[model samples]
Target: MPADGIIAHLRTLTHDEHVEVAGVGQGRRVFRVDGVEIDVIHRDLGRHHVGQCGSCALRDRCVEGFWALRVDHAGGVQPCLLRDDLRLGVSRLLGDPAGLASAVAEHVAAFTEGTL
Candidate 1:
């Protein structure tokens, strides 16, 4: 999709109590969803890092270590949003922003009911 379309869709998805668009730029966006900050990286811009390394589970290991498989987005990994089951739901929407919005809404709703 076009950049504008993506941005618009993102804004719509995040327009809720559980999610909000924190920032935006070319090929990138940041979201604050359900107390977790999510950075959506769409393309490689030659940058080797993103988000906070301090909170990463694999922080003790080298950058080329085993965690690389899970943390590596197109370019680099950012601090992941949520954890465990919630993270799984969000992770499934990495490439599809529209689906992400729907999933997030569902997740948030489920979370409120203590079911997520």
Candidate 2:
């Protein structure tokens, strides 16, 4: 399939399809996509001393719980989004780096456009 086609398929999946709001480390919604670990904040609340991804305006915040994942957008410049962590056991199912790159790009496009 074309890269965009794969992106379209991912866009159709709703929050209920792969995520559930949970209370963990100052409250977060955990997203489980069979492998990757992504914790999203359902509420606009902040985690004291824990740092906020959306609020921090610094470059190289890896030490602050931010990891770099390149995202290629079909439209605008790719935005940087923070992920919680990765599950080692399911990493194999997530696929290789090249495939993951495309997936991440598509994910960014779909997410920023509100298509997913």
Candidate 3:
């Protein structure tokens, strides 16, 4: 899909989701879903930048910049995009809002079950 398509899809998926914006221009977007907190940290791909990142072509995925979504679970932080299953699942969710809610619920279950 095109960059715009992905952006639109993401907007649709997160439209009703609870979110908390943090930091300045390039900040973090914390999304709360089913008691699970997903922190999406924005990346500033500029002169000074550091962190593990995904290969999504849409350089500016969010308002700040490119983002990396990680789930805050009981055990530890689970990288949402780094894992193949999650990446694919998220892609699927972005494309279909009707299924997005259920998909998120499933993700929560998987996370709590230690399968994600």
Candidate 4:
């Protein structure tokens, strides 16, 4: 798969069940599963996103890869972006600690089972 493909997959992962960990222009942010820094931008803060900030100044530069999302375990919903380096880091972490992925999957499965 292409490099961008990896980031895209990571992005999808966030959209699916993970939480946000970092925001754009907020410097490097870390993830919970592993200590990887991912670049993050707001999804709603897209190019044509004329919501807040009295009109986005960096709208142009904030087009592609604009909004970043990651996971946050603060007991609430948080949006963050998983940068490329972070993504690669997580992929590595999962291999060594199969427990990491299993833990998450098991939790998800338990939740689905409604035994919570």
lDDT by residue for model 1 (2-111), tens: 34565566667675323222222113455656667654544332123223333446444422211122244433222233233334325656799898667666644454
Compute the lDDT of residue 100 as modeled in candidate 1: 68
Which residues of candidate 3, in runs, are more than 4 Å off?
A: 1-86
Quote each prediction's TM-score: 0.26, 0.24, 0.26, 0.22
Candidate 1's displacement at residue 5, Å, is 43
Give each model's clash number. 0, 0, 0, 17
The CA lDDT at 69 in model 3 is 42
Q: What is the C-alpha RMSD of each candidate to the true structure, in Å?
A: 14.5, 15.0, 13.4, 15.8
Candidate 4 runs further than 4 Å off:
1-70, 73-96
TM-score of 4: 0.22
Tens-digit lDDT track for model 4 on 1-116? 22345556566555432334343232222222234445433344233221221243443444333233344443211121322222212333445567656655554343334332
lDDT for predicted candidate 1 compared with the true structure:
0.41
lDDT of 3 by residue, 1-116 (tens): 22344434455656544333432224444445455655554343221112222233432443342233454333222334334344323553466777765766665555434465
Q: For model 4, give the 10-residue run with minimal summed lDDT.
A: 75-84
Locate the minimum summed-lDDT window of 10 residues in model 1.
62-71
Error of 2 at 75 (Å): 26
Q: Clashes in candidate 1: how many?
A: 0
Winner on TM-score (3 vs 4): 3
